[model samples]
Target chain A: MSTAIRDDYLEKLIESWKKEASPVHSVSYLDQLREDALDRIESLRLPTIRDEEWRFTDISSLRSMPFPRASAAPLPGLDKQAGTFLDETACRLVFVDGQYMSGLSSLADDGSITVCSLSELIGTRASIAERYFGQLADFQENVFVALNTALMHDGVCIVIPAGVSVKVPVHILYVTSRKDVAVYPRCLLIAEPGANVTVVEEYVTLYEGASLTNAVTEMYIRDSACVNHIRVQRESSQAFHIANGSVLVAQSAHYDSVSLALGARISRFDQKIILAGGNAECEVDGLALIAGRQLADTHTFIDHANPHCRSRQLHKCIVDESAHGVFSGKIMVRPHAQQTDARQLNRNLLLSDKARMDTKPQLEIFADDVKCAHGATVGQLDNESLFYLRSRGLTEVAARNLLTYAFGGEVINRVIVPSLKQRLEEYILARTRIG
Target chain B: MINANSKVLLEVRDLHATVGGAEILKGVNLTVRSGEIHAIMGLNGSGKSTFAKVLAGHPSYEVTQGTVLFDGQDLSVLAPEERAQAGLFLAFQYPVEIPGVANDQFLRLAYNTVQGHRGKEELDPLEFDDFVREKMKLLKMNPDFLDRSVNEGFSGGEKKRNEILQMALLEPRLALLDETDSGLDIDALRIVANGVNQLSSKDNAMILVTHYQRLLDYIVPDYVHVMEAGRIIRTSGKELALALETHGYDWIHANDQATGAQP
Candidate 1:
């Protein structure tokens, strides 16, 4: 066992790294990278209640508890529970304790796409792995991100060749099977030029007790390519989850991502989409259902760096009991990014007096000739609408449930995949029951 | 069949209501006995709709000074839901579309709420399905309608018929039909009128509010009240409706002014 890691511990670690001799096998650049990460972790500070981004979500409870690093051990009793979350045709990649379990995974025999553990790729295909391993994500600036990047053991790597399209979705199931254990799971997806693919990433916890999952996903879409990404987070109520997704869109490419947040005691999702090429399009849609004393925060940034790019975002949230939900979406169009059309909308429904939701949709356009707009609304179910339903013979509870379901359903229904949409609908209905 | 001596169902004493700082109904009085249909005909802004809304406890309308007694209980003291559970139904002119609630679920909940208020046990979903099916048959509505979202994509005629179906399920002591004939075609009007006629009973009352006498032609009222401004100036039997139809509301207003009577 080791002493708990804190800010002082990070600082001490950085100080020791500056004086200690370099390891014998690793290259100079890799050693410097590790040292740089350690220095950044020492300098970067954790967000507190005073920070606006951390207003609704408090990490004090997490900081007080002792978190043990997840061991590279085989997980038992997961096969019984994993079958329900994965579809039949999905190329399932399973990971336990932040280590890929090849024996537990099932891949398509056809091999339209290459799927392997990040550690294996880093060892065998060092050049291809080195080019994108940690370029898109800036862990040094964020504490949880830095911690994950520092301790990440193994991850999932997916690559689709040029002009190739995979019909079946690739599934990455990351599960935490132990209590008081901390797992850092990473995933990197690279789609070559003119490639089309769909990826589904899910995060779940098998145990109901306390745990922590710090995960990051980086996706790179090349020229004229299309990628559909879906993320479903269903952690236990006693779990703390911090997830970050970074996407880079190339020339004339299209990127679509949908996130469903229905779990975790305290969850923070940070996503960024960079339009790096001309005539590119990006769409991000998300929904969150928070109940009990849970807190969920979703922050997104859409950076329009090129011309003739368009982006659309809509995030809906339903909060019940003493739950709190936060949404902060910012769309930025650079000065050279002319002819940009971007829109963002955030709507929230509060179901109880103790429940609260804070939404801020912001647009910062430096280009004079761009069309950008953002709007946010936080309100309860319309009284007139409720009475209207009740007058139609609905009970008060039934009327409220119907309206809430509809409010959340509007976003869920927009999912293009019929099977995924049906699953989401059933999940939402089940949550609405307790609400 | 509605019996003649079923007793009074609704009693209004100088009911006055205002909306947004403007007085709509000014000291208007009316009474409706069970088994009798009363017609309230008025031009636009004459407070006819306000009268219906006030009876249903709409929050927008403020009752300045008045008492509405429904089946021996004070209506003003009840919330909108409480008033609804008390057997008082108001068919809105523009029915609100609740996009997510199923039509059948809404109907069953409303029926059970009213039943619970009347000290009766609520029916289970199976029993309620049977109950609503019978009422749907009476309104000539398809069974598929029960599965659709409440009025989300319903036609104007369908919305009105759905309202009538709800009235049939609740079996209210008093039904206030507010502009129920608007946006309805001849066939829809006939069907709606027929449904209302079938739901009427000696132990229940009805007040039909409309601009035209066309609805009165189908659902004949025992009494007619012609309103001007915020007051009912003339009260007559079924024949006065014919007179008003033949001469228009202007003629009645002129006659009232000539006689120096307040409208």
Candidate 2:
């Protein structure tokens, strides 16, 4: 009887999502990709706690909710919402409810890079889209990625030309303003050989009711190219956010990313990075600050496929009230990848007796001459350290919050963007505030 | 700075304390007055450090039976921060290293908190920086030390010096120095001693917990007390520290058998 109800729910969800496709002149390649995604989604079902990877994260709440796709409607007072923008950078792309808003975004006209909304440049950049779109992030078995690929309305496309250095950072802002709505946001970035650029991906919401945001991002760095990706998610606590990011690092290329999960009722971030050539390096740092029944789950896979590669990862969580935080990081050094150095650490702070954290760091090194070290620690405030602070005239509550703020600050300080860094720091302080 | 008629600041009567259900302080009694410096000399298990921790209200140490009066107010009921706010300071033997908090920021916060409690005007960052720099000179600390995390990667002597540096900033009325001279070299000892001596005034009292008389050579104490088996069995002038250095603790254990018994 239970299986019958579950099967019926799956059929209903898929039927509702099929209509989310663009109702305009569709390109043949993208239509074929969408057909493939739809076929994959039909074979998969919503994950339960019984699955090994989903054991600690129970997304059953999302499976049973309404999956209504957002309709394109002009948002009132959008100009007044400019406060959500970062520093004055002309190179920004805006997407509201999975649809690109051309009037709300500005782009640098220097011609050093190509930034476009796939909806606007579908005719001219179809070749670029055909080469990389729906490629890095495999949707073979992942339902969320498959759904995003099948339903993405307007996707972000960035191309840094060869040997060009794009000094102006590009910002891709994803906004959700409707309740009971599911928004699928997509992005693809390709840095040519010896080219460099920075991209900021932000997910925010003006909706206070149950909402869903499924985002997919794919990045490719060519030989000697460098890319910095900073992803920030600060949605309403009543929203559910799931994101998948795939990156490929070429010979001697560098990838640096810092992702922060500060708000959400239930959020999961899945990232996979592949170092395809020798001497490729990547630094992936993440921080999740959740409280009051919120749950944040992060899973990362780094594959050192070539020789002489290095990967560094540090993920931290500050759990307060009855919130839960989960981290699972896997670093793999292929059999032939020698001289690969990898370090991964996950540290958690439990502020309340009911707060929970499940952290796992897995390192699989097949090379004989490789160095890989991983560690995870979950603890409350130190009694000795607390006493030391209280002895210095700080109240017990003040001392505890300070220590908690400092724990999350380690990752926040790594953000070189001054305004964003300060914003994250203040968010940590406010969340850890003691009454 | 000693005056026989100085006002009493801290008075402990029949104190008893246990750590992890093991009694470490038994029936210890002491009286401290303003304008005086007292040196406590003892062996490892003599409970001198435990007494200092209990006075500072360490959480691990439970006062099974005791009554402590700080400036004639019952000190047992107050919290550790309350004690600190009421002009009490303990220089930990092993100072803790706080990683993310800058040394200058921690010191300034502590100073301002204590100053606010005392109803004194608080100084801004510029003024406090100028003032603290002058105080750091007494301990021969570099200005860059303020920029680093509190005591993180500091040498043993540097940690001890930081303890004294805090002493100068807080200006507690009753200070307890718990083995502050243990990790110091000769040069560091001189600098620390000079700093403590300069912080001492006619309205403040300090008790130095040490195991050797060498510290007494630099910071001359007005009185010296010998603790044996959780009790102060002997109290005399500063000359007693010299006698204990030469005679060792063995002979004094035999003389204090009367008061050394566990209560």
Candidate 3:
């Protein structure tokens, strides 16, 4: 059976993929997964405004652009600027245009963890790669994820052994510098039982260029394992960024994911956490600060599949000028997932009259003995509060900026690492121009 | 104590202001002298709060015809912060709540801004914290109040005390207290009034805008004026406040009608 592709973007991407003549070592498992993803993309097609999930965010602009496929061409005389998490991390991995840059990365010789490129890992540790790759993320319904799985060539792979904890965070910097190029980057993380680790994945565009990044990440946490994942996206204002992150948590395991988006013409971050075992916990937090004509969207899902699970999520957005922001979150409690406690909140602050926000919080519970609550609020700065601050000798701009930063600070304050927290605060302050 | 011959700190002449296109203050005139604690007593809708807000240059109030001179400078030409820097302060009747900013940070920023404007050395956070703690003690405020967000989850009396605490820190030359004693209990009222009395000096002046004269008993204003229909119709010494307290504001309303005051 064959299905014809209707999506212009997919068709152009596939045509480019077929024309690739470079010799790349391929594993049978990933090849099959890629084939499956292509088939799924062909069947699903691109989502339009008719779809419920794509109602608020329009992709017509993306569909009109004929983005060229980017390869692993060496960036000549390209300079690498330090990232936000550069100072504290001993292990750092750098990627440019979806391909790993070996010269720019520094791998720690620590025995407790393993860090290598995905393509290298597929050759050296094929069994472990095959066991966990393409397991957590779903491509059947998510066209972006399917596109990423089909087109992605290489990314970062991290493995933490049992009963080991890395004191410092591992930083992965993904930089894009090509014009009108489409890039797909993938990441996979596996934490063994009793292991603990924190990872920071940052995406940035080096120059002012129009690019598309469809990234996917998968994580698996065994029993009693703890993992803190931070994803920061500060691409160019002319770029489009769409990312999907999926995590699987086992018994007594803990997973925390925080995503902060401060750039991009249009960006969307989708996060999913599956509590596969009892007594597991997950916390998902996000912040999006967009100005001018940019649009930032975030969607999160937490599934409580077993008993005694807890999930907490808080997402906030500060929009200025004519920018628009959207957030949709869902917390699901299965039939047998008794004693599940889940809460979700979304707050938005519109800085201009033309700014807009759409938020939806949903709770679907089948268990009778579960507690779940969800709320959403969209408002502008308080007039009285602004006046009060000005009365206390704060400039009008300073007063507005401070309140705006405080709105996003709720999510930033949850970070456990001090340096990262301080860096995030400064980054947010500079971006918001509060100082 | 105030001398009638002292320099005038604030002068409002023929002031007429509007809010949402409706005039609230009509031809109101008053003068505040240095070292004077004056009380403006009136009923609700008598434009008591509007008068205080207009003097603070609230954005919502538009002064159509009048001039407010502060230390002989046109107060109308200054922004709220500029007015605040030029020795003007207003303790809001309803203090705004800021949920995330700590009380200490807010106070220190205000203090530093005023200090900078005055060409004086500013205190860092550590030094300001110590100075503010001592001031808070004057209001009987707990040390924990410094760490919490400004007015967030604070009781009514606590909010009132926080407003006075700011008044003490700012040390403005012309301070306007708008119903600072309304929500406070007797004890909180005494503590807040005492704080205001301690901050009063011969170089500055205080204007207490309230509905009842009960607060005047504690602050001991040198002059008390009766405001009606957006203008001061009667002015007398502090003993007049006690007379009006015994008999409600109805007589003031009647006297205004008999004398054909502005409608």
User: How high is the CA lDDT of each candidate model?
Assistant: 0.82, 0.88, 0.87
Model 2 earns a TM-score of 0.94
Give the candidate number with the greatest DockQ. 2
Give the per-residue lDDT of model 1 (tens digit) for B1-263: 24567787788998888999899999888888888899999899888988888888777789999888888889888877777777889998888887666788767777777888789888999999998898888778888999898888999989999999988888888889998999999998988899999887777889999998999989999889987778887888888888888898888868877998765
CAPRI-style grade of the A/B interface in model 2: medium
Model 2 chain A lDDT-worst window of ten: A1-10
Best model per lDDT: 2
Worst 10 residues of 1 chain A by lDDT: A22-31
Please report the TM-score between candidate 1 and the true structure: 0.82
- Estimate, for each residue in A5-78, the C-alpha lDDT of model 2 and write its tens digit: 23454667667765555534477787788778777776778788899888999988886676777865777676
Q: In model 1 chain B, where is the ten-residue run with the lowest total lDDT?
A: B1-10
Per-residue lDDT of candidate 1, residues A1-435 (tens digit): 133335764544334433534332343333445555655676676688888877767787776544666765786656776234455445879988788888778887787888888666545455666777677887767877776666565688888889899888888889888788788898989999999988888888888988989898999999999999988888999899998899999999999988989899999999999999999999899989999998989999999999999999989899999999999998999999999999999989999999989887888889999888888888998988877765544556766877888888767766666667777777876776623
C-alpha positional error of residue A372 in candidate 1 after TM-score superposition, expressed in Å: 2.2
